[model samples]
Target: MKLLMFIKELTMLIKSLRGLCLCLESGSGDKLSNCTKQHIQKLLKANMMGPYGSEWAVEEKVKRREMVAPQARYIFVYWNANEMMDNAFTPLLGFLHFRFTLEEEIPVLYLYELQLDSSVQGKGLGKFLMQLVELIAQENRMGAVVLTVQKSNSLAMKFYISKLRYVVSSISPSRVDPLVGVEKNYEILCKTFDHEAKAILEVYSVQYRTARRVGFMAAFSDLKFED
Candidate 1:
C-alpha cells in the first residue's frame, strides 16, 4: 500500500481525537532502520513475553524472523513533537505490524502485532489504530480483519472482543473442537465484513471426533499467520 494514501486517510480520521497530536508513517520491515527495529523488538517483548511464558523462547525466534520478513508492513506511530511536554520525551509511541494476505482463499488483513508504550495505554490510541486498520482493510477490498490473541492475556482478549466486537473465528481451535482447543494457548479472532466472510469465519459444525484430528492439525498449522 502507498504511504501517502494511508497518511491522507489517517489525517482525516485522527481529527476525532480531542487533544492528541499524532503522526503515522508506513514502511516495509526491511526498510526500517536498526534503531527503529530494536525499539519495536523491545516493545513487543515487553508486552508479550509474560503471556507467552515457556513458549517465548520458541515464539520469540519466530517473531524475530517474522518481524523482518519482506512481506511485513508496519505503521509506526509517533507523538507529534510539538505535542510533547518535554522535548526529550521519546516521540515513538507505538506501532502496528500487519500484512495483506489470503486466509482460506479469502483476501484479508492480518494483524501481527499492536504494541503501545505503557504511558499511552488506556488512551484511545489503540482503538483508533484498530479502526484505521478496519478502514484500510475495506479500502483494499479485504474480506475481514484477522488477528491471534493469547487466551491468557485477558486484557487483550477483552479489548478485541468486548471493545472491538471481534468474534472467535469458526476455524479457531475452541470453536472447532473444545477438547482439542484445550491444548492450544490462543484464539483466532476476526471481524468479517461480508456475508461470505461471516459464513466462512463465524460458522462451525463439525463432529468432535473428526475435528479432533483434522481441525486440530489445520487450526495449529504454520500455514496460518500467528500473532
Candidate 2:
C-alpha cells in the first residue's frame, strides 16, 4: 500500500513538473559530483544573497558540500520554457536540498534549502517544489519534513504556515526557550506525515494551538456567561 502511494507520488511530481514547464532531476549520495556541487553552490549563492546578504553566504561555499554526503539527496528543477537551440542550455529554475535524518529517533527529511528564482516567485513554483518535497518524504517513509526560516523573512513564514500548512516546530530552539532563543531571529518549522511525528514536532500549547486565544480571552475577560 505504501509502495503504491510512493509510486503515485513520483508520477504526480513528474506530471506536475512537465505541466509547469520544468524538469526534475534527483540524485542521491555521491552522485553529486564536483561539477554538480559547483552548479548548486552558484545557484544557492545567487538566490540567497538577496535575502541573507553576501556576508551570510560566505559559509555556504563550504556548507554546500553536504549535498554530496552519504545518503543526501538533491533535486534540481530546471526551466524548459525554451528549447535548447544549437547546444544552448536551458537555465535552472530552482532546487531542493534535503536528506534523511533522525528527529527524536524517528526517521525524517530535513530540508536544507528550497530555492526558486525571483522571476518564478508567486507563480506556484515554490509550492510545487514543496509538494515534491512532501511526496519524497512520504515515499522514503520519513515521518516529517523539517526546515528553518528566518524570522525577518515574513514572506517565507507566510508561505510555509499559511500556504504549506507547516507549523513552528515544538522542538525549535525559540519554542523551547523563547526568551534568549528568540534573539536568534530564526525558526524551525515542520510538517508531519504521521501521528507520531505530529506528537513529537507539533506544539499543542494552548497559546500556540489557538488563534490569538490569549488576546481574545483578555479582551473579553469581563464578560460573564449564564449556564
Candidate 3:
C-alpha cells in the first residue's frame, strides 16, 4: 500500500511538473523562475528515485528469491535508458539477466530474464555472456560457475554442455511435465573450475550427503583456524 502511494505521488508530481515546464517555457519568462526551478527539482528527484528505488527494491527482493548470494555488484548491458556518452545500446534484445554474482567461494551466472525478442535469438549474444561469465569467475577466484537447464530445452542444454564445457551435475529425472505429457528433468551444470574446485563441490556434495549430520554443521560454521 505504501509503495502504491509512493508511485501515485511520483506520477502525479511528474505530470504536474511537465505541465508547469511547458507553461513556463511558453510564457514571457525565458528563464526558469525560483518556483519553476523548485518544481523542476522535484521532477529531477522523482527521476532519480527511479534508479535508486529500483536498486533498493532489488536488494530487498534478493532476500526472498531463490538466488545465489553476496551479489554486491550488478553491471548491465543496458544500465539506463541512456548509457555513457549517448551511445545508443545495441539493438540485440535488452537486459539478458546475464547478470552474475560471486558468492563466498563460487560464482554463478544466472539466466535472470533472457529474451531476444524472437528476432535476435540466433545471434551470438548468449555466447558472449557465457564467455564473460568465465572471465569474471576466474578473476574473482571463485570455484566453478554453475547453472541449470530444463530437459525440454534441448538446444540450450547442449549449448552449455558442449560449448562452455559445463557438465551435468544433477538431474531431476522425474519431472514429467503435466502439460506436455512428457518427461521433464532439470539438469544442473557445473564446469569444474580449474579441476580442483570442481572435484570439491561435486565430491563434497556427495560425501557431505553421506556424512554424519550431527556435528558437521558446527565444524564449518566458521573457517577461522586457531590453536
Candidate 4:
C-alpha cells in the first residue's frame, strides 16, 4: 500500500490518543531526521543488546538502517512536559516500527520493533502501544498483528503471551518443526482477528504435528537398546 493511503486510513487513530499523557505521532521512516534516527538506535540498543547477545552487533547494523526505509511506518511516542520531572521538554519515550505486508499469503501488520526507554518499562505503555497497533491493523483490514520475539527475552515473551494473548504462530519455526526449530533463536508470534487468519496463523497444522512425531520416533529408533 502507498504511504498516503496508509496514513489516511489511520490518521484519526493517533489523533484520538491526545488525551494520553504520552502523545503519539505517526511518521514514515523516510521522513525521520538523523537525530531522531539516532535516538531510536540508542533506545533499541539499550533494550535489545542484552537479549540479542553475540548476535547484537550484526542485528544492530540491520536495525540502524532499517528504521529509515521508505516503506517503514512508525508511531513515535513522547512524554508530555508536565509528566517529566527534570526537564520541561517532552522527551521521546519509545516507538513502534511496523510495515503493512504479506506473511504466508495473508496481509498483516508486521511489527519490526517496539522499543521503550528504561524509565518507562513495566508501565503499561508497551501494552498500550501494542493495542494501538492492533487497532491500526483492524482499521486497515489487515489479517493479523505479527511480531518476532527472541526466545532469550523471557520477559518480553511473557508480556506478549500472558498479558496480550498473542500465540506462537503456526508458521513460527518452532511450531513448524521442533527439531529444526531448536536451532532458531526467535519465534514468530501473532494475534489473529478472523477465522481465516486464525487457521493460517495460529492453528498448528496436522503436517507439523506429524513431522514432530516422526522426528521423535526416529530419534527413539536410533537409541541403543539397553534392555
Candidate 2 wrong stretches, greater than 4 Å: 9-19, 54-58, 80-82, 85-90, 204-227
Pairs with steric clashes in candidate 4: none
> What TM-score against the true fold does each predicted structure earn?
0.84, 0.77, 0.46, 0.80
Model 1 lowest lDDT segment of ten: 204-213
Residue 112 lDDT (model 1): 98
Clashes of 3: 0
Can you write out model 1's per-residue Cα lDDT over 122-157, one digit (the tens) per residue? 878898899999988988889999999998999999
Candidate 1 deviation (Cα RMSD) = 7.1
For model 4 the local lDDT of residue 2 reads: 60
Q: Can you give the lDDT of residue 203 in candidate 4?
A: 90
Question: Per-residue CA lDDT of candidate 3, range 197-222, in tens?
Answer: 65544444533534635356767775
Residues 74-120 of candidate 2 have per-residue lDDT tens digits of 78877664644444443666778888899766688999888776656
Separate clash counts for every candidate: 0, 0, 0, 0
> Comparing candidate 1 with candidate 2, which one achieves the higher TM-score?
1
| Candidate 4 lDDT tens digits, 139-187 | 7889999999999999999999999999999989998888989999999
- Best first by TM-score, ranked: 1, 4, 2, 3
Which candidate leads the pack in TM-score? Answer: 1
The TM-score that candidate 2 achieves is 0.77
| lDDT score at residue 138, model 3, on the 0-100 scale | 54
True-structure lDDT of candidate 1: 0.87
